[model samples]
Target: MTAAAVETKIPASAEWMRPGRVAVLLFAVLSLVAFLLPDGVLPAWTRQLPAEFRIGLDTWISAALKWLVEDATFGLFTFKDLTRGFAQLLNVPLDIATSILSTGLLDGRGSSAIQLAPPLPWIAVVGVVAALGYRFGGSKLALLAGGAFLYLAVFGQWASAMLTLSSIVVAAPLGIAVGLATGVAGYRVPLLRRIITPILDLMQTVPTFAYLIPILFLFGFGPVAAMIATMIYAAPPMVRVTMAALEGVPREIVEYGTMAGTTPRQMITKVMLPAARPQLLVGVNQVIMLSLNMVIIASMIGAGGLGFDVLTSLRRLDIGRGLEAGLAIVVLAIALDRLSQAYAAGARKRDAEGGLKPFLFGLAAFVAVTYLLALFVPPIATYPEALQISTAPFWTDAVKWINVNFFNVFDAVKTFILLNLLLPVKRFMMAQPWPLVAAMVGYAGWRLGGARLAALVVGLALFPVVTGQWDYTMMTVYLCGISVVVAALIGIPIGIYGGLSPRAWRVIEPAIDTLQTLPSFVYLIPAVMLFRVGDFTAMLAIVLYAVAPSVRYAAHGIRNVPTMLMEAGTSMGCTQKQSLRHIQVPVALPTILLGINQTVMLALSMLVITALVGTRDLGQQVYMALTKADTGKGLVAGLCVAAIAIIADRLIGAAAQKLAAQRSGAVDAT
Candidate 1:
């Protein structure tokens, strides 16, 4: 060959031999071979770990937990006594909050024989909310705050909503306190951060139901168990956010505080924390949202209130009632989310006129007047039963109409998807020999990162096998894979369109926010109603629960792409489509991958919840363990789920890093 021709051939060969291209080609070949194999199954020898080699971690965990509860003691106290005492201590404040929000002390008999104040009148509650809203966020927020409470009252959900709020009032602060203290410790101690980081990751990824069983055993099934579970589930994010905020504090500011002779305690409380106020409040916001998300799930173990109402309505397939309760929850979530966000953003600026005193006086006067009027005007004290407007009938009719008119259409679409798309993908994945699957993941990890990541991926991929839960783990992989694919297909285009247009963004952003903030349980009800309870229904619920993050991140990434590049493309006579295809998407790929990572985490979290709708995945095992009080089984299953999450998170994170590096390289080349 001529020298020029040899050079051309060599360059082409090098391109094909690139690590990423080689990894993809290798994976594709193995997958294709696996698919063509008979019964779409691996050889029997390779299907699972040997029986003797399998670890009985669940058994050991169950035994340990039992010993702790029944036999273990510290000085004079057993674990049961300690747990019971703590439960009793927590319940005192919970009972006080519930009574004040619901029945009021004046209307009920008490052991102490001290008459307490009655529940604040609905009108007074509205006035106070509006006043606080106006003080923080002006007239628009005032309307939103007042309107949400009014809807709760007028819809006759006042008692249930208040009950839920009472729990949140306690749970949120407890989560914040625990989270802040842990976060501070983690920040100050490097060794603690190293230990806490992985624990936090696992705690955040493990399904909430996994811990509920242990809590149920210790605290018994009631509000106290639910409260503890909620706190555990909600506090991780707060800790993470707090640590990040503290870490992000400018070194200059810390130095200034030090030079000013501030003590360590004063440095943290007066200087560091104040400077990190925005992020601290963001952590608070996260705690509130997570607590609210747990409301309905916590109800399964006997936490009462609106969540209980929603659960009951759904169990009966009472669409209208479920919808009403769901809407109320959404409203509550939005109101709290917005108020906290506004406060964190420092929306409140002290007014020159009267500052804080007049606002306090006005609030007191509103309370007194409303209380006095409630003594005579019954509707002001409690929303009048006669005037209550129930939307349950309307929602019930809507559900019926949807079932009657669209049943065949939905069924046909569902059949096509299951038969043609989801089933085949699942079979392909399940068919692979475990060793081959692990190798493929390891190769991809190595291509993106290096040998260390390859080892990590292989270890995580083999985790379920060693634990003797390989089959259930594969089932979870199938569900998560299908849900993520569908979510991306639907969400990415909407995100791109919205990103490209201001008007569309304005309309789309709020809808995405609403979808994200709505409790995960609410999605399940509609899925069940529309499709009935099965794998498809479960997948549908996962898709709805997980799609919002994809849309949000996609839009944010595309929109944030440098404007100069788009203009340059225009100047070069490139069409908008060309610009989007060739420039915007490439730049945004890293961010979009992060979105997919979030979607994976969300789908895994929903796995156990979706199991409630009947699917024989690992989630079902967790649910079964919960019912049987098998702590070992539940924890093992939960850990398998967490393992899956860790694998996906690591792989996606590595891929995103690679993409970011490539983008930087391309920029430098230009």
Candidate 2:
């Protein structure tokens, strides 16, 4: 036979040697070896990880943080002194805001106390908020804003709620200002954006709990540290929004600005910024929302207000009061969300001629009159105690009644989930060999993207093992994975329904909006009250907290499926189910994948919070570290959580893009 004939008959090279085939073979072999081997038979080196590999990362990080707090110096000042001084600086605006909103300007206490001025009267605050809402939006917004504030005053949340509002007033502006400057710089300089993008990603992906420890070390425990943390957490999204909005400016506008002979500075400030103002306002709204969320977490660190109220109540087992405070937070969030949305929509974009002056004058007059009246009318300054109502007893009784009546039912449901779903998954995850899991993840990365992504994924997956946190990592992965899967299962179908029918969307949208607006901390309240404290409760809280993104994205993806494509399916004589199955689902699959990716990230983030309910995960490690002020443990574990998130985000994103490309190619071929 000729050489070519011989080669062909020999089949060239072994098919199993191909990278994709080899990857699967390695994955299966390792998994089998891991599962079949008796616990001790795999060798401690593989399961326990060597001490050298651990590298004592937590110890090193702790030492570094300790030095920064106690020993490090800059010029004449110790690091702590500098941090304290900055905290003091922050306190000025915070004090002023608190004074204006909640605490009257008073000196000393008891007999020696002298009132400098009263805090804004409850009526004045409500009136001003209503007027501003009307000015920015319309009468409907005015009612919403005014009613929310009135509810706070009437429901006896006036003081604590105001304290929370004050923190937001301080933190939100700081976030916006700093975020704006950073964003502008990033947009102007590509090099800076490269440097900044990763930092922003880290800021956002790291658990909110991780931020508290560093601030605690530097600034000492107080509202200042909390505000600082909130500002840092909330700023990243604004920076992203700023860069995106600036990038989206019209090319024609840019040329026009240049042709008009504007200087670079003027072009940015006068031309580009104005054109991007509407979008920038949206960034402002996002900063507000994030600040509110962070403020709740920050409350644990000494930030007083509604968050503190809830925390204190829960600690004392005052479930009713805690729930009340949590609801107050919800009302505040909804009111602020609606008001900010209207503001960002730029309802005043085309202000009527000569209307602005009269409106402002009238608003000022209304506020002034209310303030003056408060001097004489005590109830105007403070919510009338007689009119105030306490639903705490009712809520407490309701929970009691439900627990007494439905304990078996709730227990049965919880038991079924744990026995059938959560426990089995947890056992499987805990038993998996680290090496096998890493290989499987890497193989997924390779299939989705390439060698680079695979290596990155494998490295990330192995990090917890090397850091001596494998058990905790497994717990976290088990809980977060199960929670995300459940959330996706629940949210995606609802989202599809909403996307398909406008009437369903109208009903579903408000419910999800309410769910999304409530701070993550609030979800824990109900979960704990019902299920008490356990992994089951944590899972419930996580599912509730993370479900919004999945619903939102799935609905968006379905709604945006091209009309022409559906029409094409119909023209081709397809039934509704057939068209949906073949055309719509395929087209929407990438977008739905994105939603799952988002759900995964949110679930991971919430999993860290779930540590509160007592699942022994990385979140618990972080929380324990926080209580001990063990910066190293908290940060390392937090980063492990982040590593998992980044891995999930990147791998899923690659898969989405791969699916999208395949669909596009198929369409082009057709």
Candidate 3:
């Protein structure tokens, strides 16, 4: 036959030879081969890295940190001296804030002495907060703001709450400032973005507790150190959000600013920043939530506040006191989250009215009236002791009742889960030969992102093994694996319900916000109370801490499905379930996957905190290392956790990209 005739008869084979398809086939084959191999079956060399070839990164990091702390000097000042100087500088404001919040300016020496700047009375503080809320957000927010503070006072938690607030008052603004500057710089400079993006990713992934040891060493244990850690922990999200917001500003707005004869500064300040206000406020909200979340964790190193109260209660097994403090944290978080969201939504509307001056005047009037009342009504100034209510007894009785009635049931469920699910999965993961596991991961990475990603994944996987942290790392993976699965099971359905119904959305969204805003440490309280401190309880805490993002993203993705498509499906006589299954679910799958990615990261971040509830994962190693001042071990373990997160991020990110491409292709074809 003629060559042309033969070519015509044989259909083009190139479609089946696509890189993605080829990669997948290769991954499947390789993974199957690896899986079928005996647990210990590997070439001798692939079992572990040779001792001499190991990098000793831990030793180097420790040495560098040691030099910085002990020997490194800059002129007359050592690094420790410099860190302490900054800490002391920060301490001035913190001390003043504490004094104002707790003791007032009278110094508790004599009430008659001429007071310097006296602490604003509790009534005045509440009035100012409510006024500010109303000024920014209207009556509903005013009620929420007023009610939260009142709850603090009536519960006799005013002083502890104030202490926590004082730290947040100091930390949140500093975080915002630093984040804004860094974000702007990163946006303007590609090199800076490249340098800082990875750092921010690392910072976000690392557990908050992991930060405390390094900070404790540098600045010593105090509110200052806690504040610094809080800033570091909270600032990265703001930086990331700000950069994203700035980058996402419409090009036309910038051009408009330039055409209007605006300078570079004016363009950014007036055009880009204003355009980016929604996202920037979201970043601010994140900072506030994260700062509050850090409160209890920071208490571990001597930061005083409601967090300290909660910690003390937990240590003493005073579930009643712990719950009260935890609830206060939750209430404070919800109020701040709502206030910030409301303010962001209303800011543009208020700006259009040109009513700033009247708002300020009204605020000033409220403050003045409250101050006047404070001078006359001492009970209003400071919450009267006689009127202070204690719910601790009620909570204690509740806990006792729950323990008496429900402990056995919870214990049985915990045992069943541990035996039927977690233990087998963990053992299987741990028992896998390192070579086979690494090969499978590498192959999957190759399937998703070619040789470069494969190399990156292999390197990340090997790092833990080389550091002798493989067992602990696998333990973490097992714990996170179970948590993510359970979260997806719980969160995805809630997300679907919320997506389909506005009423459900309104109800679920706020609950998700509250759950997300609460501190990681807070989850441990109930877990400990109910399940009583073990791997099971720890997993439960991680699940609670990690589930919100999945639910949120799923709902968002589903809600955002194209109206035209929905209508088209309906015109074809597709029922709701049929339409959702064939249309919305397919389109939303990519976003749902991204939500799962976020859940994994959140679970990893919670690992160290969960260690406090007793789990022998990498988190426990870091915790132990911190207690012993073993910088090398702590840093190594933390890096291992970051590595796991990075690997998961890259793999899932690639899948999401592929799904997006498919979605685009389908749209184009239509």
Query: 194-247, model 1: which lDDT tens digit per residue?
Result: 999999989999888899989988898888789889999999998998899999
Cα lDDT of all candidates, in order?
Answer: 0.85, 0.85, 0.82
Give each model a TM-score. Answer: 0.94, 0.94, 0.90
Give the residue spans of candidate 2 off by over 4 A: 1-33, 108-113, 351-354, 666-670
Q: Which is the winner by TM-score between candidate 2 and candidate 3? A: 2
State how far residue 608 of model 1 sits from its true place (Å).
1.2
Clash number for each model: 0, 0, 0
Better of 1 and 3 by lDDT: 1
Model 3 C-alpha lDDT versus the unseen true structure: 0.82
Evaluate model 1: give its TM-score: 0.94
Compared with the true structure, what per-residue lDDT tens digits does model 2 show for residues 1-670?
2322222221111221354786678777766656666787766766658887786899998899899987899879998899899999999999899889988897875588788999999999999899878877789999999999999988999999999999999999999999999999999999999999978878888898887898899898988899999999999989999999999999999999999999989999988988898889899999998888776688999998998888787677677898788889988988898888887786446353347788889988988898999999998889898999888899889888898999999999999988998887887777787877887898888777789999999999988988998888988989999889989999999998898889999999999988887777778876787888898999999999899988988899888876766665666676777665666666777888899998888888787778878889999999888888889999999989988898999988987887777666545533
Looking at model 1, the pairs that clash are none
